[model samples]
Target chain A: MKSWIEKQKYIIDFTLSSLLRRKVKNIGLLILYALIVFILASVMFFTHAIKKEASLVLRESPEMIVQKVVAGRHDLMPLRYRDEILKIRGVQAVEGRLWGYYFDPVFGANYTLLVPPATTATEQAETEPMRTVVTENEHRHGPEEQAMPLVGAETIGAGNIVIGNGIARVRNAGKGEFILFRTHAGEGMPLRIKDTLSSASELVSSDLILMTEPDFRRFFGIPENYVTDLAVSVRNPEELSTIAAKITRLFPDSRPIIRDEILRTYDSIFNWRGGMMIVILSAAVLAFVIFAWDKASGLSAGERREIGILKAIGWETSDIIRMKFWEGAVISLTAFLAGVILAYIHVFFTHSLVFEPALKGWSTLYPQFKLMPFVSAEQLTTLFFLTVVPYTVSTIVPAWRAATIDPDAAMRHTGE
Target chain B: MIELFDVRKVFNTGKPSEYSALNGISLNISSNKVTVLTGPSGSGKTTLLSIIGCMSRPTAGRVKLSGREITSLPERFLTDIRRKTFGFIFQQHNLIKGITALENVMLPAYPLGERHGPLKERAMHLLDRLDLSRKAHSRIEWLSGGEAQRVGIVRALINDPSVIIADEPTSNLDTKLSYRFLEIVETFKKDGKTVLITSHDPLVYQASVVDEVVRLRDGRLEGEAP
Candidate 1:
């Protein structure tokens, strides 16, 4: 083992100097290689981190959601459906959630206006027998969908609103600024911005506005006895499907959305995007393979002679191959490390401004939020196999061919 | 002693370009002697040198070094024989271009897994012996032709091989450097090292240290003089 280490040490030393001999060419290859790695790694890190953020948002949601589907279209669910869902066996509590979108014509961005749940699950379950109803409008805001965290959500009063950073930034509004909302009755209802959501939850809260129940109902003109959907919290998580089935059966027009299905939907979107990025990256890798092949196959006469002399001076074919392995490894691994680090900084530190707009998929407002780094050994190994292995092989195979020839013939061949 | 019996090297056999670089020519090189193979171009001098130095395998022949037959050894063993038993000096002094003179000298020892400090000491010592110690850190391309050639010679000696092989050592050197190379060959002979040189240059064959001369033409031996 010591001997092997010693041998590799000297070969690497030689390989480093050999690489330095052609500085411009090798540096160019390194930059191109690193650029490919940077792009691929940035895409991967962003997808993984955003998925994790989405999952965290999902974790905060109720176990199941009961939405009223009328004529195959999502309609405002009646508050009576919440009482029915709460009566299912193993169902702990059910609360009707009111939420809708407010599109500002001036900004051309849709703001998700949600009424924070007034009470906790246990409180709601305890007070279910004495509760009233609500009339509301359904909107596309997946309550479990936005990577939104409502900090001090229920504290806002009827005339006060909590806006997201995106809303605040686009509307140029802040705490104490009044945002004029156009009511469904074509009347302007003024709501003061109590606070802006933290930048930490910017991923989903970018276009979110949290208002009190009375303000939400008054702004959207939702009558009493209706809501957007029913949020079902179950005592036993495994009974979520059972309660969801019971709710759907109790109200045949209602559709139940389980947390797992929501999670899977979110997971598949990111995974599909990740897979798509890999397919696109494969084309870059193919170009890299061709570049490596060009370098390997086009060994100059001087390079051939260098191998010949190395062989003539007691270097075996294995030694030359090992030396070339070091050569390729030094260049490629450096590029890989450089690329990954740059991508990490770009994705997590800089919010991946490059190409992230496309990745977010048609969102008018982009959240400026830092994603925690999501790296795995498996991903790095996949990357190593993708980039480093091919380079090492390309180097060693040609070196082996040169080293196997008779030294005299190798030297004389270069004589021409 | 190095012995070659009826050695033959046929290139491109079974093809239209089938050619024989070495015909069944037998020769023996006594230990501690400088033997020169003198011939015109295409006279099989380098091929025979390559075969005798274990740089290649002869298609047909028995090659024995110090009474051990090695003609049929596998390539792995042949490489060991090449590394341990023989040191070759190429005609063009093919030191790798980017590395220093000392680094080029240390090339052979690198693959041997030798202790680097001692190996470097020995390499530098050999360069000193050739009056190249001052230029040991100069890149191969930066060195004068003769200095680069001397570095090549020290590279051959780095592994402390018993037999030294040189193919047209003085072909690309001026008369002064040619004489200096011959002097280095004489030093090897006096130290009990077998030296096999392939050269047609009169300065190389007519050197005072040469013990024997073998002339070749058309891949066959023409004459031998002692």
Candidate 2:
């Protein structure tokens, strides 16, 4: 084993020297190879990060949300639906949720307004119950506590609202500042900015505004008994599907979006994007394979001569093939590592600029957040098999052909 | 000892372009002696050298290297014989471009899988003996033809094989360089190495170091020179 390793070390050293000697001839191919890996890896990294973010955020979502469907579109749900859902066998708790989209024509963006549920305030009481509850009740209950303001002696008023990072940036509004918006009655309502959500939550909470229930109703001119949706929490998660069916049978016009269904939808969305990229990348890969095949098939006369000289100098055909194998392995592995590192930096650090627009979709208020750096061992292995294996395998036939040629004839053949 | 009986070489067999390069030729090469084969361009001197050197298999023949029959051996065994028994010098220097002369000399030993330290020392010693120490680190493309040829010689001698097969070694050299190369061949002979060369040059054929001069015409041995 040690002797075999030593032999490989010598071959690898020779391969490195040979590759370095032919850097100019190979630099273009290396760049092309690395760029292809970079593009594919970036897409994969960004999608994986986004999927992770969605799953994290989905953990906080209600198990099921029951909405009223009117004329094939979502409409406001009656508050009585929450009472009816709470009576179901596996239903643990039900709460009416008030949320609506507020369009600011000046900024040309829509901001979501949500009223905090009462249970959310109780859950966040570790930071001073009265003040935290007052502030949380003033704005919709955002998931991150750092984004909630530290309330002192002052109590949250009905006219105050907490906004997301994107909304604050777009409106240029800071804490204690006032922003004016047109209500459904076309009346100008000035709301005080209470706090800004943290940038970490920007992916999910961007363009979001949290206000008290009374403030949300007044801004949207909604009646007191009507709510946007009914959030249902199940005591037995195993019976969630059963409870959802019961809710559907009880309320025929109600549409219940289960958390599992939402997760599946998110999965399918990312999969579809990934599938599209694979289709597009398959073409590029085919072209690259053809390029590689052509380059490998037509071994340069200089290379053939080199092989011929090695053969003449007592090197066996297996030795020459082994040398060529080292050459292919070195190039492909180097390119794969370079491309993956670049993609990691592009996605995690630089926020995937090349693929962000296509992946994040076309929206004026797109989230400005960094993706968490996460790569699986499976992903690296897959990339290795995809790029390195095929490339190394592709060179074998050419190397064998070059190695098997008559040394005397090969050294004399001058045609390029 | 190297011996061949009824050696025949045909190119492009079973095709319209098939032509026999050698026809039932037999020869004997004694060990530790300098022998020269002299022939015209199409007279199969190089082809005969290739067959004797184990670079190619003869179509019909029985070849023995040190009395071991090798004509019907598989390529793997032939390669082993080529590595351990014979060293080859081609007409062209055939030094791979884009690498230093020392690297070219070390190329043959690389496949032997020896320690690079000892290999480098041996290669350096050969280069030093040939007075090519200065040009050792120079690229083959930058080296003069004579210097490149010397590098090729160093590469062939790196393995220290018993048989040195030179196919028209002095064909590309001036008289001075040709004499310098023959002096090296003389050194090999003094070291008890068998040197087999094919040359059309009278300088090589008339040299006192040559033990015998075998002449060939139209694929047939014309007989030893007087």
* Interface DockQ of each model: 0.62, 0.51
Residue A373 CA displacement from its true place in model 1, Å: 2.7
Residue-level lDDT tens digits of model 1 in A291-390: 8688755677778888888887778888888878788888889999999999989988888888677666666677767776778787788778877788
The collision pairs in model 2 are A138-A212, A139-A210, A139-A211, A140-A210, A140-A211
Q: Give the DockQ of candidate 1.
A: 0.62
Model 2, runs deviating above 4 Å: A1-3, A119-156, A277-287, A410-416, B223-226
**Candidate 1 Cα outliers beyond 4 Å, as residue runs:** A119-148, A151-154, A278-282, A296-298, A411-416, B223-226
Clashing pairs in 1: A134-A225, A134-A226, A135-A224, A135-A225, A135-A226
Taking the candidates one at a time, how many backbone clashes does each contain? 5, 5
